[model samples]
Each structure stands twice: as C-alpha cells, then as structure tokens.
Target: MAKSVAVIISILCILAFSGLSQCHEEPEFFVNGQVYCDTCRVRFPTRISQPIKGARVAVECRDRDNGTMTHNAIGMSGDNGEYNLTIKGDFENEICEVVVMKSPIAECAEVMEGLNRARISLTSKNGLLDTHRYANPLGFITSNPLFQCTQVLAELDLSLD
Candidate 1:
C-alpha cells in the first residue's frame, strides 16, 4: 500500500512540474499586416489609403538551405484591411514573404508587379522579444486610374513641393 502511494505521489509531482514549465513557454508568433487598393492607380499607397476589405493574402516560407517551401498560410483582410496570421512551427532558417493572392473588388483585380509581394521574417531569432511581426502593407493596383485620380495626384505633387 505504501509503495503504491509513493508511486502516485511521484507521478503527481512530475505532472505539477510539467504544468509549471508550460506556463513559461514561448507563445506562437503572429503576423499582422494590411492590404490596400491603389485607388488613384499611383502604384503606391497615398495618404488617403483605401483599405481593401476581403482581400486574399498569403505568407510563403522557403527553406533557406535548399530553397524548398516550408510553410504557407492564407488569410483575408477584414473590414479595416487588416489581417492576423498565426505562423506555426519554427522557421529559423527560412525566408518568408507575404504575397497578394486575389482582390475581391473587380476594379482592383490586377496584381501589380514589384508591389505584389513583401518579404517578411517569421523567426524570433532577429532579437525581437515580441511574438508579433508586422509586414509592410501590400496593395493591388487598378487597371485604370480613377477619373478623380488626376486631381488627387496633382494635389499630392503640390503638397510634396
């Protein structure tokens, strides 16, 4: 009876210590980003940024050594054009990028070259203590600039000078 009691106590102690260890474990990393529609067709986001809602975005991670893909996760922008992606697993030796997948709006369906994908670092090895990484805002360009875009661009140019 005493031996059984001792064994039970040992098991309980192990479980207690394991639970304590988990309390200090590192949390999963999250990537927060935004998507925008180039309303003025300026090829870049302006001060009057039009956030694209329901835009599809994805993060692709490639193995640094062999250049093979390691992970891919997709997410959609909310009403405010924001997305929060949870990256699973450690990608210490991987190159990650956020790419524009698709645009929900018909007018902004074309993905502009050079502005489509933004490279991001997913691993915490960069000396960042926080588990959240913010990627540069990705955007979609319209095939044709809006009629009011000319006036807006002129105003922007005037403000710049």
Candidate 2:
C-alpha cells in the first residue's frame, strides 16, 4: 500500500512541475510590418502610397550600454509590401529597430530621412502575452511626386483650409 501511494505521489509531482513549466514557457517573438513608396512626396504614407515588393528589411538590435550591434535579421517584403520577421532570442536592455535595406523599385529607392527606421522592443518583460510587435510603416521617397499627387495634395489642402 505504501509503495502504491509513493508511486502516485511521484506521478502527481511530475505532472505539476510540467504544468508549471508550460505556464512559464517563453513566447515566440514575431515582428510584422509593411513598406511603402511615398508617391506624393509626403513625409508620411497616405492612401495613395504604393507598396513596394521585393524590398529588403532588417531588424537590428544594439546593446544599450556600448551601442554595439547584438542581433541582426533580414527579410524581404512580399507582393503586398508586407514582411513578417521571426526574431529569435531575447534582447533585453538593447535598442532594436527595423531598418530599410533596399527598395526594388527604381523610382522609390531613396530612403526618407526620419522614415527609414522604426524603434521596437524585443523583450517579453512587459506584461504582454502576445509577442507580436507591429512596427510603423517604413517608406521610400520618390524622385518626384506622381501626377495624380497634385490633385491629392490639393484636396488635402482644401480639407485643412
């Protein structure tokens, strides 16, 4: 009788420990974002902005204390300018940013000054169960605004007025 009780207790302890580990399991981090071409020469993206396919994007993390690069991952945009990057490992105390590497479209190859990279956090220390982080849309600048952009700008000005 004592032997059976010990066996059952051991199984129960094992099950309890397994459940606790599962509860504390680390979550997978995923970063989802998009890249666009500013056809209207606007610093920000608009409804008329075109998505650039085959654009290269990179997620880089630098050590906050030394400013040295710690982690880097590259991904390419799909036909819809959407990119999903699976970031591995935790980058605690590091400053991470999603940066534009290259644009496949010739007209939208130039990176805008402040829109090239967006900062993001990669640690799960925050009270968020979902590890998915949505980054701001990064965009490339066109050499000249598209012809229709003039009408769009006019409408915008009229609305503001």
Candidate 3:
C-alpha cells in the first residue's frame, strides 16, 4: 500500500513539473519585416514619413499541386511600416502570396494613379523569413475594376544573414 502511494505521488510530481517547464518555455519563434515596392529593378525605400499607419497586409501560403491554402491570421504594419508574423505548428511547404488588404474607409489620396495591388512568393524554410524571395513589386488589382492601376515597386532581395 505504501509503495502504491509513493508511485502516485511520483506521477503527480512529474506531471506538475512538466507543466511548469512548459510555462517557462519561450514563445513560438517568428520573423518580422516590411513589404516594399520593387521600384523598377531597385527596391523602394523602407522609410515612410507619411500617415499610412493602418495599412493591412496578408501573407497567404499557397500549396503546390493543391488548391489555395488558408491562413486564418492576418497582420498589419504599424505607423513605421513594420509587421511580425507568428508562423507555427503544421505550416505547409509552399509559395506564399503577400497582398495588401483594402481598408473599408480608403481615402482618395490612398488611391493613387497607376496604383494596383502587390504580391510576392517564395520558398519558406521553416521559421525563417525570406526577405529576398518576394512577389513582384507591382501587384495586380481586380478588386476594384473601375480604377485599376498597375502599381509596381521593388519588394524583394532582403537578407537577414
């Protein structure tokens, strides 16, 4: 009977210790960066002094040979134009599509002449962000057919190494 009690206590202790260890574990790792326009062949500058503080951006992972992938989460750039994406458990190996999401209340100034959407795709190696592998600086926009423009910028060739 004493042996059984001791075994039960040991099991409980192990479970408790394991839980505590998990609490101390670091957060799921991620990479943060900004999207830019591919200006001709050169990359557009990263410094934004404008008031584009609430621009929305999305990174959609597209599966190869399979249909369009789904990423329930979305990210937005801050006033300084920066974003951090948390990529975790069960991410697929595929090319990602990064696009700009239109705000419900878009301003006329925001809609510039010859301005379109932006997109980029690359081979993601696990948790690393491939700043170099990005979509075309000029993205296509079929969302608004009335005044669609082909706005292109340089948004590739970023290196963290």
Candidate 4:
C-alpha cells in the first residue's frame, strides 16, 4: 500500500511541474514570410513595392495523393508586413503552401496572379535540420500603379503596360 501511494505522489508531482510549463520544448516548424503590395502592377515586389500591414496569411497542407486538406493555420502580418506562423507536427507526405488571404488596403485588395500561393516543404525527412522554413513573398495588386512605380519599373527594366 505504501509503495502504491509513493508511486501516485511521484506521478502527481511530475504532472504538476511538467504540465505547468513547457518553455523548453521547441516547436516542430515555423513558417515565416512577408506580404507585399505590388505597386508597380508587375506581379512582383520591386523597389517601389509596399509592405502590406495587417494582411491575413494561411498555411494549408493537403494530402499528396488524395488532394484533401490535412492541416491549416492562419496568421496575421505585423506592422512590417512580416508573419511567423507556428505549425505543429510533421507532414512527411503532404503538400504545404502559404497563401495570402486578405489585404487590408482597399487599393491593394486584388490577389496578384501567379503570386497568390507559395509552396513550402513541411517535412523533416528532407534532411534540413533547421525548423525555420521561409515561404516566397505573397503579394496583391494595386488598382492603379503608384506614382513612383513608373520610374522604378523603368530603372528595374520592367514594364506593366
């Protein structure tokens, strides 16, 4: 009887301390990227590009074979248009992507064609020991080109017309 009581107390103590704090445990994966506004209407970021603040981004993982969604997480961009989303667990055989959901600015509300989603690998089997995975910048298009975009596009050898 005494042995059983001691065992129970030991488990209770372990549960109390371990469950109370998990500060040392590192997350399985972190998805990091930035949201940008394509002011040049060139479908990509340039010198005249603007960082979109308060943009909504999502991490969506789908089954590779069946094409069914397996995991989903949402994150909001900060003042600098940067977002870091924590994704738990390993998805060895899944297709994961970061997609732009919404742009807070009315002028930059339209999704940039071919730049809406950026693919990312979420598997540990890829031999990358780093937990930080970077996704390509996702952007939205502005209704009209910004004033400076004209000269900026020319300097960069790009044209929206």
RMSD of each: 4.8, 2.9, 10.4, 6.0
Q: Give all candidates' CA lDDT scores.
A: 0.84, 0.89, 0.44, 0.90
> Of the candidates shown, which would achieve the greatest lDDT relative to the real structure?
4
User: How does candidate 1 score on lDDT?
Assistant: 0.84
- As a whole number from 0 to 100, the lDDT of residue 84 in candidate 2 is 95
Give the per-residue lDDT of model 2 (tens digit) for 90-135: 7878999999999999989999989999998898886776889999
Candidate 4, residues 1-161: lDDT per residue as tens digits? 99999999999999999976874453489999999998878887788789999999999999999999999999999977999999987888899999999999998999987899999988777999899999999989999888888788788786657
Q: Which window of ten consecutive residues has the lowest lDDT sum in model 2?
A: 152-161
Model 1, residue 11: displacement in angstroms?
16
As a TM-score, model 3 comes out at 0.42
Which residue pairs show backbone clashes in model 3?
A: 37-153, 37-154, 38-153, 38-154, 39-153, 39-154, 117-139, 120-135, 137-153, 138-152
- Where model 1 places Cα greater than 4 Å from the true spot, the runs are 1-27, 158-161
Better of 2 and 3 by lDDT: 2
Q: What is the lDDT of residue 155 in candidate 1?
A: 75
In TM-score terms, which candidate is top? 2
Error of 2 at 114 (Å): 0.9
Which ten contiguous residues of candidate 4 have the minimum total lDDT?
19-28
Badly placed stretches (over 4 Å) of model 2 are: 1-9, 19-27, 158-161
| Cα shift from native, residue 153, model 1 (Å) | 1.9
